[model samples]
Target chain A: MLEVKGLMVFYENALAVNDLSLKVQAGQVVGVIGSNSAGKTTLMNTLSGLILDQRIKELRKGGERITIMGKVIHEGQDISDMPAYERVRLGIVLCRERHPVFPDSTVLENLAIAGHLRSKVEVAQTTELCFDLFPNLTRWRRRKAGFLSGGEQQMLAIGMALVVRPRLLLLDEPLLGLSPAMQEKVVEAIRSVREKTGVTIVIAEQFARPILPMLDFGYVIENGMLTLTGSGRDLMENPEVKSAYFGL
Target chain B: MAAQDTSKQVTRRRERLDRGIKVRSEDIYALNSWREALYLLAPRALPVVALVLLQLLAPEYWQRVLISTTVFALLAISWDLAASSGMVCLGQALFFGVGAYLAGIMNHYLGLPPGLTLPLATLGGGVICTVLLLPVLRLRGIYFAMFTLILPLMIERIIEATKVFGGTEGLSGLTPFSHPLWESFLTMTALWVALFGLRRIMASDYGLVLKGINDNDRAVMSAALNIYRYKAQALFLASATGAFAGAFMTHSYRFVGMPVFALDYSILPIASAAVGGLGTLAGPALGAFILVPLSEMLRGLGGLRIVIYAVLLVVFTVGLPEGVFHYLRRKYTQFERWTEVGK
Candidate 1:
C-alpha cells in the first residue's frame, strides 16, 4: 500500500501543494486530477525524489523536508526521503508519458533496461516476462525505439515499468496526444495489466473523460486543493465535477 | 464550456508533467555492464594480434616505426579515455611534456640506467599528473579543455626559455633504450596492457555512470550519482596512462626535445582515437594502426602526409560519428531489424 498524508510542498518561497493527503491501497486504481500548475506534477516529482531543496531544514512525517510536509508510504516502507532510483529499486516505478522509451535502444533492450534496477535478474528471464506481458513489445523487441510511433512508444514505456515488476505503477498521462482509439487501447492495456499483475496503481491523468470510468476512486484538484473525492462513478456524475471538467 | 475545457487541460498538464526522473536509462545499462567490455576487448585484440603477426614477419629495421607507433597508440588510448569520459582536454601534454623533460633530466643528470630511468620517468609522470589532477576537479567542457592547454604551454615555453635544461638545443646523449627490439617490445606490451586495463574500467559499472554524466549530468545526479569523484578518478587514470607513454618516449629514443612533446605527440594519439572513434576502446588502437604507420611511411610525402591524414580524420568524424566499431554496432542493429526483429 502507498499512502500520502498531510502533504504540503513549496517551491522555494511559494506554496505549491498545501495540506494534501491521499492513500493508494494495494490493488486499487486511484487517480489524482488537476490542471497545469495545480501542483500535481510537483507532487509526483517530489514523490519520485527529483526536486530537492537545500533549505530543507525540517521534514514532516512524510514530506522530504521541513520546506515540505507529506507522507509517501510504499510497500510498508516510508521512502519519502529515498532518492528516485532507490524508489525505482523499491518497485515504485513511474513511466512518464510521451516518448519514455530510450530512442537509441531496441524495444527488447528498452524493456530489459526498464528492469535495470533489478540488475540481478538474468537477461533471458527478463525478456521472457516482459514479452509475456506485452507480446507486441516482443514483436518489436529488436527495433530502435525512436522509430516507434506514439502508441508504440507508450507501450514500450509502460512495458519498461512493468519489467521491474513494480508493486506500485504510476502512469502520468499515458494517453496524451494519442488518438481516441489509441487512448482506449492504452487504458485497456493498463486495466489488463492491473488485473493480471495485481499491482497497485496511482494514475495522474488529465484526460479523465476516458480514464475516470475505469478508476475505482478519484480526486478533483482545483488550484492545488482537493475539491472533491469519491468513487469514480460518483465523481463522473457530480455536477461540480461536470462543470469543472465536463461540459454537460 | 471554456472552463470545462480548461479543467480537462489542467488535468492533462498534470499528467504529462509527472515522469520517472531516475537516471538509469538504457544507455546506462549498456555502458555499465561487461557487455561494454566485450565491445572494446573483442575489437582491440584485432590490432594487437595483427601487431604480433607483424612482429613475426617484419625485420628489426622497422623497430623505430614499431616503437613510435606502439607508444603513440598507448598515448591515444589514454587521450581517448580522458576525452570520452567527460569533457575535453587538449592539455594532456601537461603531463606528457613534463614527463618527457623530467625523464630526460633524470636520465641525463642522474645517469639513471634504462631499467631505473624508464620506471622513474613513468612513475614520476603518473604521480605528478595525479597530483595536478586535484586542482582541476571543477573544470568542465571547453573550460576544462582550455585549462589543460593554457597552463602546460606556458610552463613549457618558460622552461624552454630558461635553457638550464639545454635550452633550444634540447637534452642529448641520454641513451635510454637497452636494445632497439626492446623499445618496440616494451611499447607493444604497454599498449596491450593499457588497452586491457582501460577496456576493463570502461566495461565496469564506473564507465556506465561516466556516460550518464556525459549525456545528462543533472539527471545522473538526480539519480544520486557522484559526478565529481567519477570525473576526477577517470582523469587521473587517463593521465597515468599518458605518464607511461611519455616516460617510454623519453627513455626509448634517448632524446628530449620540445618539438617531440609538441601538439603532434598529443594530437597524434587523439586523432588516432578520433579517426577510430571516441569512447570505443579499439577506436584509438585502430586509429594508431592506420594513421601512425601511414604518417611514418608517408613522411617522405612532405606536407601531403598530414593533409591526407587530416582529410581521413575529418571523413571518419563526419561519416562515422560513433567511430568505426560503433558504426558496425549500428549496422548489426539494422541487420537485426530487417531479419529477426521485424517479425
Candidate 2:
C-alpha cells in the first residue's frame, strides 16, 4: 500500500506535480491516467524516489532545480527523502517510460542485472515466471534487448522489473509508441501479472482506453491535479471520461 | 494532529528569472532606448577596454606575458569551436607547430618579412592540417581524440629522424616583429576578431548545421546535408585560428623549434576551455586570460607551481563542473530569489 500526501514537485518555476495526492491499497491495480505533460512521469519518479537522484544531479550541474515537497508513506513508513536504490530494497520498482534497456545486453543479461539483489534460485524462478507471463519474450531470451521489437522490448522491460520481485511495480506509459495489437498484448500481460502474483501495480498512462478496464481504481489527472477518481467500471461509463479520454 | 502540523509548515525554493532588460533586448523592436543598448554592449565592450588598459599599464615583462596569453587564448577559442562542432581535438600543438614551421621556413628560406609570412603560414598551415586530419575525420569519439593526440608526437619524431626542417636544433635566428607594441597590439586584435567572428559564425544558420552534426550527425544527414563537408569546413576554420596564433608566436619569440609542438600548447588551451566554459567562444578566451596569467603568477613557487596548478584545475572542474563563465553569465542575466512553494 502507498499513500502520497500533498505531493508538490517543482522543476525551477514550473510546478510539475502541483499539490497532487493519491492512495493505493495492497494487491490493487491503480491507474493514474493523464495525457502528455500532465506530470505522470514526475509522479512515478517521486513515488519510486528516483527524483531524489535527479534533484542532486541537476543541483551539481547548475541545471533546473527540482524541489519536492511532500511525504511518500509506504505502508506508514515515510520514504519521501529515501534514495532510489534504498526504495528498490523496500520492494518499490519502476519500469521507466519508452522501454529503456541496455542496447548491447541480451534479454537474459538485462534480467540478470536487475536481479542482482536476489539469490540465483529466486532470479531463476522469476525469469521463468516472466517468460510464462509474456510468452513472446521466451523466444527472444538469447537475442539482444535492443534488437527486439518495441512491443517485445516493452514486455522485456516489465519482465526485467519482475526479476526484482517487486512488491509494488510502477509502469510508466507501457503502451507508449506501441501498435494497437501490441497494446492489447501488453494489456493482457498486465492482467495475467496481477492475476498470478496479486502484486500491487500502479500504471500511469495516456492510453486510457486500454488501461481503464483493468484498473481496480482509476484517477484522472490534468495539469498535475487530480480531477476525478473512481472504480474502473464507473470511470469507463462516466460521460466526462468518455469525452476526454475515449474521444466519444 | 499530524495533518494540521504538515499544513502549518511553509517551504521556499530559489527561483531564477531573466532580468527585464535582458528579456526586452532579446527582441529587435524593444531596443528603442539608449540604456537598453548600453546594457547589451557593456558586457561585450568592457572586456576589450580592460585588455587594452592592462597592456598599456603592465611592465615590459608582463607585456610579453600578455602576448603569450593572447596566443593561448586563440588556441582555446579554436579548441572550443572544434569541440562545439563535435570534433574533439587533442592536437592543438599540431596546428601551432605546423604554422610556426611554415612561418619560420617562409622567413628563413624565402627571405620574407613578418607581414607576409604570418598570413601565408596561417592559411597554408590550416590547409595542410585539414588535409592531414581528413583521413581520421570519420572516426568518432575517443578514436578521433587518439588520432589527434598521436599526430603532433608523430610529426615530432619524423622531424627528429629525417633531419628535415632543422631537426633537433630547429630553425633559429628568425626575424622578429617591428615592435613589441605592434606585436602585442596585433595579437590582441586577432584574439578579439577571432573571438567575436567565431561567436557570430556559430550563431548563424551554417553554425546550426555544424552544431547539428555534433548533436546528431545522422539526423543532419537525413536532412540531406553532407556532414563531412561541414566538418571539414569547421576544422579549417578552427585550425586557421590556431595556426595564426602559432605563426604570430614564431615571430614574437624570433624562433621556431620543437617546443612549438609541446604538450603545454595542447593541454593549456583545453584546461582554459574547460575552466572558463565550453561552447561559448568568449568563455574559453576569458579562461585563457585567467589561466595563462595565473600560471605566470604561480611561476614564483618553483617546483610546487605545477602541483598547485593541477590541484586548482581539479578543484574547479569537480566543484564547479558547469564552468565559471556559465555561472557568471546566469547571474548577470538572471536574478534568483526565494519564493513560497505551491503559491
Candidate 3:
C-alpha cells in the first residue's frame, strides 16, 4: 500500500501538483487520469522519485528551481526524500511516458538491463512472464528496440518495467500514441498483468475510455487539483466523466 | 485522505523575478526615468570607459598585454559567432594564420603599409577561409569541428614543407604601428565593434535563421530558407573578425611567423568563450579579458602556471557552468527571495 499526503510540486512559481494526494491499496490498479499539463506526469514522477533527480539537475544548471513539499509514504515508511534508484530498490519502478526504451539495445538486452537488481532465476521468470504477456515483443526479442513500431515499443517498455519485479508499478501514458486496436491490446495486457502478477499498478493516462474499465479506484485531476474520485464503474457512468474523458 | 499526521512539514521555495528596472529598461519606457536609462547604459558604457582609462593610465608592458588581450577578445568573439551558427570551430587559428600570412605577404612583398595590409588581410582572409570551408558546410557538429581542428595543423605543415613567405623563420621587421596608443586604440575599437556589431546582428531576423540552422537545420530547410548560405555568411563574419585580430597582431609585433597557426591561438579563444559564456558575443569578449590577464598574471609560476590555470578553469566551469557573464547577468536582472508555499 502507498499513501501520498498533501503533495505539492512547484517548478519555479508555477504550481504543478497543488496540495494533491492519493492512495493505492496492494494489488489495486489505481488510475490518475488528467488532460495534458494537468500534472499527471509530475504526479507520476513525484511518486517514483524521478522528480528528485530532475530537481537536483535543474538546480545545478540554475535552470528551474523545483520545490517539492509532500510525503510519499510506502507501506508505513517515509520515502519522500529517497532517491529514485533507492526507491527502485524498494520495488517502485516507473515506465516513463512515450515508450522510453534503450533505442540501440536489443529487446532482450533492454529487459535484462532493467532486471539488474533481481536474481537470475527471478529475472528469467519475469522475462518469461513479460514475453507471455506481450507476444508481440517475443517476435522481436533479438531486434533493436528502436526499430520496432510504436505499439511494440510501448509493450517492450511495459515488459522492461515488469522485468524489475516492481511491487508498485507506475506507467505514465502507456497508450499515448497507440491506435484504437493497439489501445485495446494494451488494455488487455494490463488486465492480464493484474490477474497474473497481482502487482499494485498506477497508470497515469489521458485516454480514459480504455483505462477506466479496469481501474479499481480512479482520481480525475484537472489543472493539478483532484476534481473527482470514485470507483471505476461509478466514474464510467458519471455524466461529467462521460463528457470530458469519454468524449461521449 | 482525512487528517494525516503531516504537521511537521515546512514548505518554502525561492522565487526569482526580474528586477523592476530591468523590465522597465527592456522597453521604450526606459527613457521615462534617469534610473532606468542609467541601468540600460551602464553595462554598455563600462567597457568604453575602461578602455579609455586603460589607454591613458596603464604601464607600457600592460598596454602590450592589453593589445594582445583585445586581439584574443576579437578571436573569442569570432569563435562565439561561429559556434552560435552551429559551426563549432576548433581551428580559429586557420582564420588567424591566414590573415597573418596574408598581411605579412602584402607588407613584405608588396610593401603596403599597416593601414592597407590590415584591411586587406581582414577581408581577404574571410573570403579565403569561407571558400576553403564551403566544401564542408554541410557537415554538422563534431565532424565539422574535427575538420576545422585538422586544417591549421595541415596548413602549418604545408608552409614548413613548401618554404613559402620566409618559411619557418617567417617574415620579420615587416611593419609596426606609429605608436602604442594607435595600436591599442585600433585593437580596442575592433574588439568593441565586433562585440556590439555581432550582438546587434544576432538580435535581428537574420540572426534568427542562423540560430534556427543550429537548433534544427531540417526545420529551417522545411521553411525554404537556404541554411547553408546563412551558415556561410556567419562563417565569413566570424572569420573576418578573427582575421582582423591576426592582421592587427602582426602589425603590433612587426613580425608574422609560423606561430600564428599555433594551437594556442585556436584553443585559447574557445577556452575564453567557455569561461565567459558562449552564444553571447560579449561573454566571449569578457572571457578573453579575464583569461588573457589571468594568464599574464600567472607568468611567474613558470611550469606550474598551466597547472594553476587549469585548476582555476575547472573550478569556474564546475562551480558556475553557466559561465560568469550569465551568472552575473542573471543576478543583475533578477532578484530572488524565499517565500512560503501555498500561502
Measured by TM-score, the strongest candidate is 2
Q: Is the docking of candidate 1 incorrect, acceptable, medium or high quality?
A: incorrect
Question: Clash totals for all models, in order?
Answer: 9, 0, 0
Candidate 2 structure quality by residue, lDDT tens digits, A77-182: 9999999999999999999999988879999999999899999999999999999999998988899899999999999999989899999999999999999999
Q: Better model by TM-score, 1 or 2?
A: 2
Native-structure RMSD, model 3: 2.5
Flag regions of model 2 displaced more than 4 Å.
Answer: B1-10, B29-31
Candidate 1 per-residue C-alpha lDDT over A127-234 given as tens digits, one digit per residue, 9 for 90 to 100: 675566556666687899998889888888888788788888888778878999888888888888888788888888777788889888887776666777877898
For each candidate, the alpha-carbon lDDT, in order, equals 0.71, 0.91, 0.91
TM-score of the A-chain for all models = 0.86, 0.99, 0.99
Candidates in order: C-alpha RMSD to true structure: 21.5, 2.5, 2.5
Report the Cα lDDT for residue A47, model 1: 69
Clashing pairs in 1: A35-B10, A35-B11, A36-B10, A58-A66, A62-A70, A62-A71, A63-A70, A206-B11, A206-B12
Candidate 2, residue B312: lDDT: 91
**Which prediction has more favorable TM-score, 1 or 3?**
3
Off by over 4 Å in 1: A1-248, B1-46, B59-61, B216-226, B329-343
Better of 1 and 2 by lDDT: 2
Q: Note the residue pairs that clash in candidate 2.
A: none
